[model samples]
Target: MSRLVQRITASIRFTPACVFPLLIGGSAIAVFLAVFLLPVYAKNNSLDRAIQDRREALERQELFAPIHARLTMQLREASSLVVGDRQDIQDTPKSPEEAVYKLSLLAEQAHRLGLLGVTPHPDSLSTQDNLAAELRLAGPFPQLRDLLITLLAQPWLHRLERLEISGGADVEEFRVGVSVRMDEGS
Candidate 1:
């Protein structure tokens, strides 16, 4: 046994030449695992998370589809009444007074479409031929809540830019700014 142990020690010799190669090989393997394998694993994990998020989003959209469809039909009916009328008024309202009158008329039409307390500000003009307006209304809190929910269900490209609700007001109303853009070529 002593003779065999002596032979093994002689083979290694604990020399710098053999020790340096072993250290270099071990370090290369460590670097390869850290830089290559770890990033691939991380990327696969991120992809899985992204796929899960998309699936959840699709499910929510499906749940909202029926409500969204009803709101869209209502919007289409209202929009058809207002679209052509706007073109005639757009080019003619040069003065602020004329603008206000046109805005009021537009608000009235909007009110008939389930929108309450529609008010169009004369100052809400844009350089583009976009109509800007503010609407205020007061009603039962439940009705207001339903209106907001329905608004969220609207499929139009419109956005509710701002909303203000307060308890002390004469009417429990929410104020919202509404705008619609006219295509230039039209």
Candidate 2:
């Protein structure tokens, strides 16, 4: 084996033929890498960059997850409150007489709340389109405010059409009118 190695090393020489083939083979391998493997490496690098960008975007979205959850909970709470208010306003009077009776009851409630001369004028109310009436009451400013709030807080679709207030600062007279309508869709 030692003799063979010596012979092999001695036979190999730095001639033009040997150097020429080695250079050609080396150039061919370099050309193959440049033509095929370089583009593949470039594409893999670009894909890695894209993956990194996506991971960063997902992390940014995770940062806002708590705010998104809080907003969704608040939205659900607001929706529930609106649903409760709609349920409260769902009470409707079946007929004009019932509507008048309800108005009288409201007037009595105002009288009980320290208002004097609580009167309801429902003579001009028509049942064909919508029920409307005017109420006259005399009381202090606080009682009038309370009566207005009570009227607005009733369990039906009620609209205040006109409001006229007159008198001194302490004892005020209110001529407030409201229009009541039933929802057809309900």
Candidate 3:
């Protein structure tokens, strides 16, 4: 053999075992990092991002605190109006027949406010203390706008779930459905 080959063979034969073991150990560490440690690191990063998103949502809710407080106060005041002034609402119809009478009175009141024609329909009586009514009104555009403003300004809680307005030959007419829920305890 050449001098270089003889030296290489002698080094491999003597210090040999440690070189092979080191190579294998380095490869095992690389495989473990690729297959196990890398994925765990990626998962931790994703979890951190999710936590950040939740913190931002909580901060947004805190920013709306004043608006939420004001709305809650308005709702409480409206509810009290219905229950507190019992005398004013004492004549409100209790029976189905009487309810229809009261509805007519409300419709007439609407008509006087420049609404051309007003009609109110009450559904069948339920065991619950809730009352639901549908009101249909027809008139000029300006008058219809005014009527809606007045209805919304009422002290009682009235939810206008749906409103349909159509243009007619001489005027615009509106069909509105209003629902009122009264607690039995009230």
Q: Between candidates 2 and 3, which one is better according to TM-score?
A: 2
What local lDDT does model 3 show for residue 15?
A: 63
For each of the candidates, give the backbone clash count.
0, 0, 0
- The list of candidate 2 runs beyond 4 A from truth reads 1-90, 111-124, 182-186
Clash list (residue pairs), candidate 2: none
Candidate 3 TM-score, C-alpha based: 0.41
Model 3 local distance difference test score: 0.59
- For all candidates in order, the CA lDDT equals 0.57, 0.66, 0.59
Q: What is candidate 3's lDDT per residue for 5-78, written digit by digit as tens? A: 99888777536777889899999999999999999999999999999999999999899988977885676566
Whole-model alpha-carbon lDDT for candidate 1: 0.57
Error of 3 at 130 (Å): 1.2
Residues 48-127, candidate 1, lDDT per residue (tens digit)?
Answer: 99999999999999999899888866765554444434332333344334444544444344332234555555655544
TM-score of every model versus the real structure: 0.42, 0.42, 0.41
